[model samples]
Target: MSGRETGATAYLLREPAAGDVEGFAELHVRVWREAYRGLMADEVVDALSVETFRPIWSSIARAHAEGAVVDDGRAMLVAVLGEEPVGFVMVGPARDEDAPAPRQVWSLNVAPEHQGSGVAQRLLDEAFGDGPGYLWVAQRNSRAIRFYERNGFALDGTQAQDRHDGVTELRMVRPD
Candidate 1:
């Protein structure tokens, strides 16, 4: 495991309820700051706020409950401990114009404390599954890249600058 593992504990996986937005948003900021410490400018990462993501999570939850997940290969699941989300995974139709696969892993994040407790893998499997897909990982994000590799993704000589943070990202694809 790339991140530290405390002994495993009981955790729940489920669809994100509207009430989970605050916790999920906080988790998003925490995971990004922890995971991208050296890879992104501190100011850029620090500027991220839970307020910015609350509506995003709310909309996602509402969409899911409305049965909007039937098409587009979209799915998301959160790993929770009590009322807080320890980790989450989101997948959907690939957004790139020349995407390698129809499916894309939009995001997979776990709090630093929960990193190696298998919560990440559980969320990933519950959302992304074994189907063909692709994802972009920051070039120097070795831990995430390795995890993706272990799950059957491999670099495909493609690169792009992240629109938000300007980080270089490499494309990895899992073929059908």
Candidate 2:
């Protein structure tokens, strides 16, 4: 909470700024390469490294400038580390026709350098906010599966195709 700890050590999760776009997109490109290199096709992941991906900052800035809040009944959380934007999680109503209700994690990504540092957990804590929610992860992403399991999410016996890579994924959920 102090300036010293925050700036040098502890990560500070906050609304991202439009200025953060380029940096975040850079981090995203790097981290995705680290986390998905072998699990996904190299060409597909490489495509995401383009400059247009910099919209990350603009997207977060728009939501922040609009005064979007957790209690505002929407589900989008962007995590920042000190002066740098590092990760983001977006949640929205479940889109699957068989889902019982609305409210699910649409996406979650953390910079590879920041993973295992409790950043994703903090993001999930904010996104779930005292309720049940669901998310999907590539079935082959054993690391992420363990991370979600540690946070109390369980396999929901559902599966889907990942639109970006055409990989099979499992739907997982945590009920409050």
Candidate 3:
């Protein structure tokens, strides 16, 4: 019982089964490694594994399987080019108390080779639907910041630092 799809790729957005968990986890790791290398700490990047993505995807899959749908709801969208997953965008209601209601992009990642092919943009278009959206990006991730900016997201001047991880993040938002 996942959210409804809006385009020709509806079938690609199907509810993920328990078995799909592994592929989802693998995609997360692969895309992160391919997309974030050099942008993030090599140690942190190398330390990420399927184990880290497992719980994250498992929770999303479970929620998509059981959560109630809302008006302007949000969900995860994985884009597969042929049989291989090339990108994924996790979107939903803005959880940040500082953000406007409606849609938020918790994360968006595309394989380095597959980027600029509209995979990420298509996923965002489907999930956010021209609505107001917000996302947090690591401050050091200049590439992502540019991407977000190019997509119309503006810096909202919010910042936070992870005490344990020491990563700095900036909040960006877009009006509907």
- Residue by residue across 1-176, what tens digits does model 2's lDDT show? 11223223566665566566777777768777777777778788777763756665566667677776446346666677667777787777777887744578877898877777777777777766647777888888999999988877899888887776877889988886
- Which candidate number has the best lDDT? 1
Global lDDT of each model?
A: 0.84, 0.73, 0.72
Candidate 1 stretches greater than 4 Å from native: 1-7
Please provide, for model 1 over 50-107, each residue's C-alpha lDDT reduced to its tens digit, 9 standing for 90 to 100: 9878889889888767877667578788877766679888898989899999999999
Backbone clashes in each candidate structure, one number apiece?
Answer: 0, 0, 0
Model 1 vs. true fold: TM: 0.90
C-alpha lDDT (0 to 100) for residue 108 of candidate 3: 84
lDDT of 3 by residue, 26-105 (tens): 88888777766776778988998999989987877776667643445667677765456666777777786667645688
Candidate 1: clashing pairs of residues: none
Q: Give the candidates in order of lDDT, highest first.
A: 1, 2, 3
Candidate 2 Cα misplacement greater than 4 A, ranges: 1-8, 67-72
TM-score ranking of the models: 1, 2, 3
Candidate 3 root-mean-square deviation in Å: 4.0
